[model samples]
Target: MSTASRIAIVTGGSRGIGRAVASRLAAAGQDVAVVYASNDKEADAAVGEIEAAGARGIALQADVADEAAVTAAFDTVERRLGPVDVVINAAGVMALQPTRELDLAELDRQLRTNVRGTFVMAKEAARRIRPGGAIVAFSTSITRLRFPTFGAYAATKGAVEALVPILAKELGGRDVTVNAVAPGPTATELFFDGKTQQDIDRIAAMNPMNRLGTPQDIAEVVAFLAGPGRWVNGQVVFANGGAA
Candidate 1:
């Protein structure tokens, strides 16, 4: 997965899959801007890893759902790293509860980061990404699994999936790619927050590999899309190890 050096901006790059994506991209010779909502210490450490991989790295703070903040983050990336070639909206939130008892406030929170965040990032990427650039958004395989308690979270990613192809077509002449990576039961803080050991084991066994996905596993798919997988545009890639 070799690619010419390019500039990439990864939201939520301070941790989990986004952090892996940032390090992976940098290792592949891309200058990376790690956009995190907060947690400057973790963000700085992520940049340290990127720089350790021999690529220029910086950390920026912004609320993904805030249009002005997103715009400013992009401006900073452009000023510090040059025009962005890859924009990955991996900033997301999850709240798992049955629809009957779902928390409306939690739903709102998920909507803000997952749906609105992607919306803002996609709009910015469409406007600012260079020719031949790529935009990647996070989705979840829970939509296909139809699991209980994932209603609100899946709904937001569903919105992400819906938005991707439409944006791809809207950017038809620009040579930029817009796609979503829908991961299944990944082993991240976001995924493990509520699950018990038994819950995790059962879910892991459902997949053929009998395991949960690693953030790095998802990052590999994203790295491909961000780098040389230009032909695979406007699709939701299910990187779930056949869980669904």
Candidate 2:
């Protein structure tokens, strides 16, 4: 892949799906800013991979849920890399708990981080992105599956799916596309932690592919949307491999 002059920002780019998306963009020749919450080490590692792929890379630390921090992060990226040509809102949290046992604080955190943070990043991207740029937000198959303990988390992702069309309309005249990617089960740290072999097997069997999705699996779709698939706007492209 040859690099384009485009610049991209991948929130939560320090690890997992975000990191994969960042690397994909880099492979396509876009300078990438890998944003992380706290760990500069992980962010640096991602940046190194991007540089190795022959694209310029930078690591920025910011809390996606905090408005000021998010604003600063975007501003820094723009200052360093010029106007963002692509924005992938992949920063989110998953909190699992039955409704009766769900703590109010945890519920609030999930909503604030997933829903509000997405909104903040999208709004900022709408304002700052280049005319031909694209924005991709993260949703989850859990929104459709509606698992019992995923009420709050799924609700937040559902809100994101609902926003895609409106955002696409808002950015229409500017030739910017807005979309969301809803991924099913992926073998990320989030899924592996606190899972026994039995739990892992059950989760894997839930997917028709008989295996969990990989971060790269999801990133490939994101790369398409951010590049050639610009015509596909206001859509929630599910990359779950028939899991949902």
Candidate 3:
């Protein structure tokens, strides 16, 4: 990698794991453009953290599932930050319901953002990412754990995992890597949303680390995949701290 600062696009970057990844990339001297769904305040705060890390930062709002909006966001990044060197497709949504009683509307929402949004991001990345660049998408440890009530969420990510290697092979000889990070029970607002303290503790104890994964914990993996972890490509990394 050149000493010339690279640019990174982190979706869902207004909060949670995405925000942490943006900050980490910035600290490593990469300018980061955070693509958030909504919440102007949070997005601005995320940019502040990135800029405070001594890297350039910008916040752009877009619905990840909308192709036109996503495309426009990509154009804006290029116009302001230069060609994209890294894209972290971290935007996603989840609704916990038994597969038997699937909430059709919620399922659609998850599919739109998780599966379709990932595909959209991947498509843009495949077209725009510079050589030696990387495209990192988000998956969930629940996919491996077979958790109940995670059926729709896991389905979307399963598609993402399947897409990883196919896209990598398609981008053959491009010096770009396509990979995903399946994070375990991270301590994010999204994860803590419906669980009780006991539920959280039980899930945490399932892993050898004996605690919930943090946003920073997963951000480290994204930084590696998006930076110098070149030999690793077209694979889904279990960043779950020995969970499952």
**Every candidate's lDDT:** 0.93, 0.89, 0.94
Cα lDDT of model 2 by residue, 1-244, tens digit:
2339899999989999999999999999899999888888899999999999999999988888788898998888889988889999898888789989999999899898899899999988988998788999999998877778888888889899999999999776898989999998899998787779998888888877999899999999999999888689999988877876
At residue 4, candidate 2 shows an lDDT of 94
Tell me how many clashing residue pairs each candidate has: 0, 1, 0
Sorted by TM-score (best first), the order is: 3, 1, 2
User: Of 1 and 2, which scores higher on lDDT?
Assistant: 1
C-alpha lDDT of residue 69 in model 2:
90
Cα distance off (Å), candidate 3, residue 238: 0.3
Q: List RMSD in Å for every model shown.
A: 1.0, 1.4, 0.9
Error of 2 at 89 (Å): 0.9
Evaluation by TM-score, superior candidate among 1 and 2: 1
Candidate 3 clashing pairs, residues 3+ apart or interchain? none
Off by over 4 Å in 2: 1-3
Error of 3 at 126 (Å): 0.8
Q: Which parts of model 3 are misplaced by more than 4 Å?
A: 2-4
Off by over 4 Å in 1: none
lDDT of 3 by residue, 1-244 (tens): 5424899999999999999999999988999999999899999999999999999999999998888999999999999999999999999999899999998999999999999999999988899999989999999989999999999999999999999999999999999999999999999999999899999999999989899999999999999999989999999999999988
lDDT by residue (1-244, candidate 1, tens digit) is 4565799999999999999999999989999999998899999999999999999999999999999999999999999889999999899888779999988999999999999999999989889899989999999998999998889998998999999999999999999999999999899998889778999999999899999999999999999999999899999999999986
